[model samples]
Target: MELMTFESPVNAVLSGQEAPERSLKRRVPMTARTKQLSDKEMDALERQIPDLAQIATKTAYARALLVSDSVLRVDSGDLVRISLDGSKTVVAKAEPRRKVKVGEVITVRRIEDQTAGGRA
Candidate 1:
């Protein structure tokens, strides 16, 4: 009696044996989802928004001036001279609108020089 052997694809690969050719096939399904907004819906959304141009710039609680001296000062209610880059701005100091101590940080509305405005 003679013994015969047959090799399976998976077993042949695992045992370092050559595998026979076999056709492979795969099945896939197509799927999709989409939404559309009606013209009425768009018009309703537009009506809910207020006109942006109606918005106004924020009012400042306190005013400030920056001078070339690298000094930031609050309006002291007295006229003060701010000198910047060879220019001067004289801003009438108003009573410190906000409690500000010496050496407090204050942003200036605009950059000016010593000649900007002053009694001098």
Candidate 2:
């Protein structure tokens, strides 16, 4: 004896057009719910994961005082050097998300890679 394969007689069945068996097992509709976290719980979760805070701080854009057209003072201790043209200053290699002004504050973020033993 040899095994043989059979095809559906109707094209609707072959093309999965709401067959009787499939229609019988209907899908259940899902309901959406919003969840809110308390400030203390959120703080506890942040403390549990120190890297989350580090990542947030690193990605967050901050206003830095432009010491000069080419230099920006992020804080009392940090200074960032940027490229300066006649009237334009470029901070990073990529296009900045926000516009910058000379002799004024600009939005910037510090990008750093945490590596082990100084090797990537």
Model 2 spans > 4 angstroms off: 1-31, 35-44, 48-50, 60-78, 82-120
> Candidate 1: where are CA atoms >4 Å away?
1-34, 51-110, 114-120
Q: With candidate 2 superimposed using the best TM-score fit, by how many Å does residue 119's alpha carbon deviate from the native? A: 33
Q: Pick the candidate with the highest TM-score.
A: 2
23 Cα displacement, candidate 2 (Å): 34
Backbone clash count for every predicted candidate, in the order shown: 18, 0
Please give the CA lDDT of all the candidate structures: 0.41, 0.41
Tens-digit per-residue lDDT, 1-120, candidate 1: 333335433333334433344323233333434558799998987876664223211111111112123223344455544443434344555554578789999886643564323322
Residue 100's lDDT within candidate 1 is: 73
RMSD to native for every prediction? Answer: 29.2, 21.6
Q: In angstroms, how far off is 42's CA in candidate 1?
A: 0.6
Candidate 2 per-residue C-alpha lDDT over 41-103 given as tens digits, one digit per residue, 9 for 90 to 100: 889887868886665443331211121224332333333343234333333344334655778
At residue 46, give the lDDT of candidate 2.
79
